[model samples]
Target: MTDLRDVTLRDGLQLTGKPLPTARKVAVVRELLDAGVPSVEIGSMARPDLVPPLADTLDLIRALDPDELARCWVWVATPRHVERAAEAGAVNFQYCLSASDAHNRANIGRSTEDSLAAMPRAVAAASAAGGRIQLCIATSFTCPFEGAVPEERVLAIARDPRAEGARDIVLCDTLGQAVPTQVTSLVARVAAEMPPRRIVYHGHDTWGLGVANTLAALAAGASEVDGALGGLGGCPFAPGASGNASTEDLLFALRPSWLTPSSFARIVRLSGALLDELGEPNRSRAAQGARTSATAFPWALGAEVSCR
Candidate 1:
């Protein structure tokens, strides 16, 4: 079975101009757990001025129920962030590195090599603090500033995370410019170096290839995928970037296999409600189309439509 990680609370809120209230974030976490999601990327411990939405990362982590807290993951941009997350009871930590130096400089105010050099220390600190690490190689396919990223460059940086005890390595299409063929080839190359089961695909829908690339990654042997509810995420520092692949759409695509039709529908409803509450537009095309269809022909149906 493929594992899905919901990143709605972290990456989803990273670029939103307004911050989500602590109560609403806690509510969303509970709803996601109830929907049967195995893992959730709860929040990030980045600079408060850089990513204002996550200023209350510690409080949010504290608000989670004991059981949910055990399953939550937080983003760590530095060793300090990892230490803070560990102190706040987060056991799973995600570290992101850009494949392109130019993009990395723009995003993190450092070169790609600098970020790679810092990983061992951060990973070691997290490990010492009893945290499981997941490393994300961002702009793995194409970089907004530098364009296409070479396969060798990605593989080289990926080695650092694996060497530093990262349990999972996620290949991210940070600018959403990847296609199926590229995803397949890159995933195949990485899978040759590491266990395919440890590979995760994190994609954006900017070019409308997020789902396609994810499917390609799975076909190429990746065992896990990441998505945000209602397609609500983007890298504010990555130019032309858009939301991550929508969880509702991905569940619909994986229907009858990893997700039941009823569960998929439930997630869709919950996502719509959550996005509405946040005063943000639901970026899921599948959800938007469904709402449009229902509105356009209000009297067409006699009973509830079953996804099954």
Candidate 2:
């Protein structure tokens, strides 16, 4: 079975244009963990002025138990973020950097080379603080302004990060432009150099291929897969970009083999409820179909119509 890691708090809040208060964040974190999500990316250490929702990340960490904090990972985009996370008692850190030149310049005010050069320092700092670090290689599939990232560029970045003491690396399809074949090929190639456990897949569903590409990654020997709870998040660069593959949707698609049907359906139900409360749309096909199915609520259908 592939390990699923929820990125709801980090990726979900990106470009949301709204701030999630501390109380709401705490509640959401508690709810996600209680749902048996296994792992949840709970927050980011990026600039608070930028990601205001996570302004209380330190407080959120303080409120969580050490054991609970161990299960919930957070992002650290720079050494400063790493220091802040360590102070907040986060155990696992995913240090992120954009691979696309345009994104690197715009998002972090640096070149891809500069970000790469700084990665070792970030990893070293996290290590010194006794935190596990994963270098997240963003925009592995496509870049909005650049478009069509070459395989060589991605492989080079992966090699450098791997050499920099990064225990794990994630290939992020930030723009959701990855095809199944490409996902399979890239994961397979990366796995050849590193252990399968060291590679993670972060795919988006922009073209309706998130779950398909995830299956491809697993087939290609990827051990970890990243997703969000209810298909939250959008690419700021790519217009109309959707969220990561919903955890519920991924489980549903992986069902009858990798996941039990009942277990998968339970998570889907919870995810649907969370989305409803957030006033967000349910983007899972299976979820929408189930909601509309006659068996969902016999009384509602009957109450609305008569067989006459």
C-alpha RMSD for every candidate: 3.6, 5.9
Report the C-alpha lDDT of model 1 over 1-308, residue by residue, as the tens digit. 77788999998988887768898889888888887888899888877888898888899988876689778888886777888888877778888778999888887788878777788878888888777888888899898888899999998887754345778888999988999999999998888888733898998998998899998998897888889988998988887898999887776565434455445556778889878877888988767655677564223221243443
Model 1 lowest lDDT segment of ten: 296-305
TM-score of 1: 0.90
User: Candidate 1, after superposition: displacement of residue 57 in Å?
Assistant: 1.3
Prediction 2 global C-alpha lDDT: 0.75
lDDT of 2 by residue, 162-196 (tens): 33678888888887889999999888888887763
How accurate locally, in lDDT, is each candidate? 0.81, 0.75
- Residue pairs in candidate 1 whose N, alpha carbon or C atoms collide under 3 angstroms: none
List where candidate 2 sits over 4 angstroms from the true fold.
161-163, 237-240, 255-266, 294-308
Error of 2 at 91 (Å): 1.2
Instruction: Count clashing pairs, candidate 1.
Output: 0
